[model samples]
Target chain A: MEKRYLDYIDDVVSRIDTDSQTKNKIKQSLTEHIEALIEKHGSLAYNKLDPVEKVAWEFSENLQLQDRKEYSYPWPRRYPVWRRVSQKKIFNIPLYHITDGYNPETGEFEIARGIFAFGPVALGVFTAGGIALGVFSFAGISAGVLLALGGLSLSALASLGGAAVAGLFAAGGMAVSFGLSIGGFAVGHIAIGGEVFGEYIYKTTTGEGNAVEWFRNYLPYFVKFFQ
Target chain B: MITIEIRKELKSGVIELAILALLVRREMYGYELSQKILDLSSGQIEVKEGTLYPILYRLEERGIITSRWQAPLGRGKPRKYYYVTGKGRQYFAGYRKEWNVVVEFMCKILE
Candidate 1:
């Protein structure tokens, strides 16, 4: 309603990094709020308002802008204590065990051992973190018997991650498998991806190719393998 | 007095729960909502319009609440009325439980 308030609103809006639609919505809401305040106060001049009212308006505008910045760039937000903590062991076991380093006493290059282990060289029934080997593994580099999901997973029956190599089904950015594989670059008995090199390949980018017959033929075998 | 930083952080954390709890009873406009918070808190909690609106927008985006513009019967600008959605109620129920736990723990520790 007033020029000063409109100027303040404009300044606040300009600082926000959101899209035009959101910006407009915020502007409309803020304008309506100020208008309502004016109606309640029975005054057009901001200076004429009570000290408490003035402070409330100022605090409201500033805090809203601060919150916008916080939300837009959420990296600075405080995480819970439990989420921040990282562990190398479970139940006092040498899970992140290492050997063959400068100091053996420090447990460098040691083979890890635990139910859920994580380390440079780890082994467990269900393991994760760096260089993991387990029944169900997830790591930067991992190998599992049944299922593996990680950055560079290998030697799994069913693996899903980046750069995966599996015996059965594999899905990743770059996958190499004996059975069906789906990725950006796949090579398998039945490969499906943007760029595939296999006997029965299905390229999705160009939308040209026929792997339906191959899939239909192999569907029963695939289901049997899973069973 | 508690430091401004602590006050800000505390307010930010609990404001959503407070607003949702208040809105469980009835729909409210921006000014009315702020005033109700003040009244309910006995002036202990103050919901600034600036902070209240952004939180409302975020809640709306998450489909926790819905808003509609209501025209005045006389000759004033239409006001946007906000109502908590079913999703909001479900979330609030869980949040309220967690909040009660925190409150109980704090009370025990203080005692």
Candidate 2:
């Protein structure tokens, strides 16, 4: 009985970080809690309890975690925010998750991962949030493997934002790409803007700035895409 | 039930709030704290047994609560007792106001 209980305690401790001192301290506290449990259960029935049966409550379908008014994850306008996760999954990631809040202890925002993730910080196949990363993304600041749309965005294929950067195409107030770009300040192989810099640059309203070169690795893929 | 999933979902985070509230009243060890929650709430705040440790550890880690072992003046085993820190009291004061507002709104809305 003791051994099985110790094994359960070990399982819990293993989930915590690998600091020996912290682990030992946590182990001591956990053992005391367990002893308290035993005292309540009467040591005879203590071994009958299962911890796994106890833990599924955290992830069950009906779980709702509401954040304080100060937190608005994907957007910055709300008093309270909540996240609901779908049951479906891809690569063990949730199908859709809308979660955003900073951990009080870690002070890091909760990361939302899903095919369609929306939160303060999100990663998914299609993501939209404050800080987004995905194959297709839209946010205040975002990176997209295929296409990005937001205030500031970086994309492998195309980017559209106030300030945009891409390998193939970019269109924004300040746009930079390897292939084609159109913006107020544009830089690309074929650039069109008030102030432009590239192998071929066109001035529209008339502006001037020193040419700044860029280094890129995805230019070959872009050449293939254009071809 | 409109409340099953709601209760379960609301349990974990609010558990911390409840702990701080109870500790503000008086210090208690793990078992006592758990039992009082059940009794006061008419068993609604049914904590998954033994899960209190992790929450207590988290509270301690954040400096919201502290603990010390107390022996019954040379009789039985020493039990670790927990009490709220000054920081916890201040935090609870703010949290209590928030909860009060929330509760008032929820009551009006649900009614």
Candidate 3:
């Protein structure tokens, strides 16, 4: 029976491509439902039934499928589904990729909702902007150093803020309030270290090359390491 | 004799678990799982492929189960076969225990 349950779990898992977080949600939900099912229907022999037969019986009773392409929910009963259209629809201007935003009345952004609508395009732009800011800090003179450092700090804060915002979209609740506040400060320190390193690069003889050239040499290394 | 409301409630709660538990027994693919569930239920349960995939994916994510791409055995598209994990065993154990307790509690009340 234990083996059977494990096999059952494997079969279900094979059918979907859910991420770890969503998987956890499914697990919790399944645990509850499984318990409920077992309460309602128990051992096959004791109940004069087969386990496989009993399980299938209960499943058919509960699970449902709706084929929207074949059928639509009758009007006035439509649920607000998170429809995925291209970010191009919202702003209609090239390079303006804002998809989801906070309710204007609430005056607070919901990070999770934005992530859903914006998808990877918005996230990529935000991340690239942060990396650019971090890299530029190193190509500075003494006065430029201070400004670069400040910029780096701000960038880090913004990146962290962005991450929390993204997570909020993923998590969907008050988890954002606490996460953003602490994440904001942590980003500041990251900028400080990144700036100091940038200064060293500027002073070093290796700083002769253009920023693009330097990145061209180093970007592959970073990608390889991450991979 | 369960009412429609009771049936709906049961479906929401137990259907996924039931499908998952059945697959744990052997290496039956999607169609087999669907057919088995239907047969067992005396046609009381019927699972379409679309609804089945979402539930299967949700199970896969937890590391409780894993899958492999397999050549077509009999009919339809090339299928992904699933197998249970150590974590799934432990999880099912907990599920079984809790289920027993609930059943016992319910039986006592009904009696």
Candidate 2, residues A83-162, lDDT tens digits: the string is: 55666888898899876544322334678789998988889989999999999999999999999999999999999999
Ranking by lDDT: 2, 1, 3
Q: Best by DockQ, which number?
A: 1
TM-score of each: 0.46, 0.44, 0.36
Clashing pairs in 1: A97-A110, A98-A108, A98-A109, A98-A110, A99-A108, A99-A109, A99-A110
Tens digit of per-residue lDDT, candidate 1, span A117-193: 65556687777767788898988888999888889998759888899999998999999999989999999988889
Ranking by TM-score: 1, 2, 3
Q: Who wins the lDDT comparison?
A: 2
Ten-residue region with minimum lDDT total, candidate 3 chain A: A138-147
Q: C-alpha displacement of A187 in model 3, angstroms? A: 49
All-Cα superposition RMSD per candidate: 20.1, 13.3, 20.3
- Tell the DockQ for candidate 3: 0.02
Residue A9, candidate 2: C-alpha displacement in angstroms: 2.2
Q: Model 1: how far is B57 from its true place, Å?
A: 1.0
In model 2, what lDDT does residue B31 have? 72
Candidate 3 residue lDDT tens string, B66-103: 77756664643444577777898787677778777887
Query: Is 1 or 2 the stronger prediction by TM-score?
Result: 1
How well does chain A score by TM in each candidate?
0.49, 0.55, 0.21
